[model samples]
Target: MSRYVALGSSMAAGPGIRPSAPGAPFGSGRSARNYAHLVAERLNLDLVDVTFSGATTAHVLHERQRSARPQIEALDGSEELVTITIGGNDVGYVPLLMAASLPAIARRLLAGRVRELFDRAARERALDDVADALRGVGTAVRGRAPQARVVFVDYLTLLPAEGAPAAPLSVEHADLGRFVCARLEDVTAAAAQATGCELVRAGHASRGHDGWSADPWAVAAGLPLPWRPAPFHPNAAGMRAVADLILEQVGKN
Candidate 1:
């Protein structure tokens, strides 16, 4: 039997929305739908779900190095596939962007000087930290499962557009979102190249301003629970979209 190990954050763990299965957690009032389970079901592989809510790449390394609680040894000696979606929480980048944007909104509420200052600093730090974390994740995954086909997925773009109005604020939030996503892509791609791991560009499937204009994947922000997470997290449909993209890449590899 081909065994698969999936490691990452709540997105990989299927927090808000995922395909239903026995023993799955139920909290966000949505079915436990994670892309890992979806990929496993699609490919009919034995899945080792080593994912947790609020996980970062650094967290994964610590757990592996120390065999800490929620250790990834649960997926040790993997046989075939290894999918990872990490680095979003590292440096608390996402929250930082949200925080920085809030005060700017309290003032003039535009992507002006204040937004620029916060975004530039946050993006630089996040990129560097995430790159380091990806290196660690790549090394750890390769060490554990030498034969497995490892994949590192990039974060999805969450911003609206240049001139669109964003909820709870202005379109400036979208700009920061784009900046963060772009940096994530760079670090993930570079790390994958350095570590000889396959890169999965999950961001392309996201509904950006243009994509949302045609076909939106996630609910509008500040709508309601089960529609969207706090702000950056995906809804059920968004998770499913991610699962689909992951399965596609996994199948090709």
Candidate 2:
């Protein structure tokens, strides 16, 4: 049996997948059907999934959620595989991106004045902080699990690519959404490269399968899933897609 460690935020945790983790510190939401679970089961690996909803890179490094220790506690020298999907929460990108797509706010996206509403400089600085934190996480995980094959799985796509039918979002909202998500991928990519971690290009792998497509791995902004909290986030299919991505990169049959 191979030892595998999984860590990261809700993207890796799959909050809405069903039958949440048994001891998740009261409100640290989790799911047993997350991509980690799917991948571990498919590969027949010993899984130590400590993924949590809303977890930041800091949480994985040292911070704790209530009674739960850091996510690093789940890993040990014997691990053969490790996967992490974090950093988005460090900049609070998900909620901000979802809010940006709201009708009340998105309706004003076409206006140039939208840029004047928020502190763009502050937001950029926050993203910079995320970049720094991600590098630290990559480095620390490597130090702790030196023998483990570390795969830094990036976040999945939320909106369509540049040119596509914007069924779920207004044209302007779709553009803004893609831009935000693209930058997020760029940040993660840079961190992955800097840390010598294997980068699983989820943004590229999930291209046409965005929320706007006929068959979406992720849900559209306004379309809420029966189980998930937000209208945005990955569905069951999305989790499976990520699992497949790992398999592809790992040369697994």
Candidate 3:
């Protein structure tokens, strides 16, 4: 079997998704059934999955996260495939959604702090930086594994395109979250185009499968029960969907 590598943040790691992947670093939260694992199994590839919960592009390309090395350190010219799902944490997308899910009194107390962390202008600047960083990641992967087929997998949609705000998130917060997600998707697409890597439009494919939808792919705000997936993160169904998408994309190439 050819080698395959998975890299990126929590969205790719599949935290709280039951049955952690073997050899996953402590606190990485990598799931055995995450999309990368699913794709690797379907394609019969030797998978090197280094995705981790809460990783940013900096961690993927350069910096260390938790006790693990930089994600790209797992890659080499022997790989046949690589998938990336990052940049959400860099712009505070889910973090802002989590803040918005806070209790009313807590929201009031933390509103200023949250805004300071996710101000619109600041997020815009960060998106630009994320775009550049994503390009850097693609370039680095090409240099290390020239034969690898790289795919940029964007985050799944968390809100409906047009609908009333879901529980635990006000209209304003929901709107802001949507805006951030859309911008992140755009940035990811642009980077993929610039880097000549394949793009899996997970965010676009997940439009009607928002957290509040009947067949939700993402988890809405809820209690942090051990059995439950992380709030605002992709669920099992979403991972399967994304794995299918990647399979289709790879098949075409």
Candidate 4:
């Protein structure tokens, strides 16, 4: 059987929104039916889920450097496959994006003084530091698993419902969100290229869908919870979608 490795944050961790029962597949927040598990099951491969809730690229690096256990340790020899989905929590921007509207936030940005808000938050929140850390991660992965096929997953665009009551977001906010994603894509792609890794455009899969839309792989509010243990994780359907993507990529490789 092929050995596969997965790395990233809450999305990878399966923090379901619904409450988790004891000994459940996933604890609280998202569900255990995240994309990784889905892919693993489809491939019938042994999977090492090296993901943590609220993990940042920097955190990934720090943990690898400090651990010796298989789950927490750095990659050793090259494997058949490896996937990473990180960087959302680096700046802690997801919460802001989810809570506020871009149009309302953009007004503040155009005021010239608003740039400070972004810069301050990026600096204080460790967003600005992610690029270098990601590069380092790429280098490390390559060094340890030189022959393994590495894949990096990107974030998707997030939009609120049409005319939904939401926190004010200025046009600038929306633009900035797009801008941030673009930069992230560029940086992550660069890292993947440098490490000989493939870039999996996970975000593209979410296009044309808002957070509230029924996502086979995503557990959001108002949806009937799937896993009894991990309510926020993906249901079986969601897992299938993720599995399909991975299987497709693996076949290509």
TM-scores for every predicted model: 0.79, 0.86, 0.96, 0.70
lDDT of each: 0.65, 0.78, 0.88, 0.58
Cα error, candidate 3, residue 40 (Å): 0.9
- Sorted on TM-score, highest at the top, how do the candidates line up? 3, 2, 1, 4
Prediction 4 TM-score vs. true: 0.70
Off by over 4 Å in 3: none
- The CA lDDT at 155 in model 4 is 59
Identify the candidate with maximal TM-score.
3
Q: Is candidate 3 or candidate 4 better by lDDT?
A: 3
Q: Which scores greater on TM-score, model 2 or model 3? A: 3
Estimate, for each residue in 87-181, the C-alpha lDDT of model 1 and write its tens digit.
Answer: 87774545544554465435455546445445667668767977887887888788888888989876655556667766554555567666677
For lDDT, the strongest prediction is: 3
Q: Which stretches of candidate 4 lie over 4 Å from their true place?
A: 17-30, 64-74, 98-128, 160-172, 212-240
Which stretches in model 2 have alpha-carbon errors above 4 Å? 22-25, 103-119, 163-173, 223-230
Q: Write the per-residue lDDT of candidate 4 for residues 212-238, one digit (tens) a residue.
A: 455534433232334332222334454
True-vs-predicted CA distance for residue 72, candidate 2, Å: 1.6
In angstroms, the error of model 1 at 165 is 2.5
Residue-by-residue lDDT tens digits, candidate 2, 63-132:
9876778998888788888998998787656765555555665637544434432335555777788888
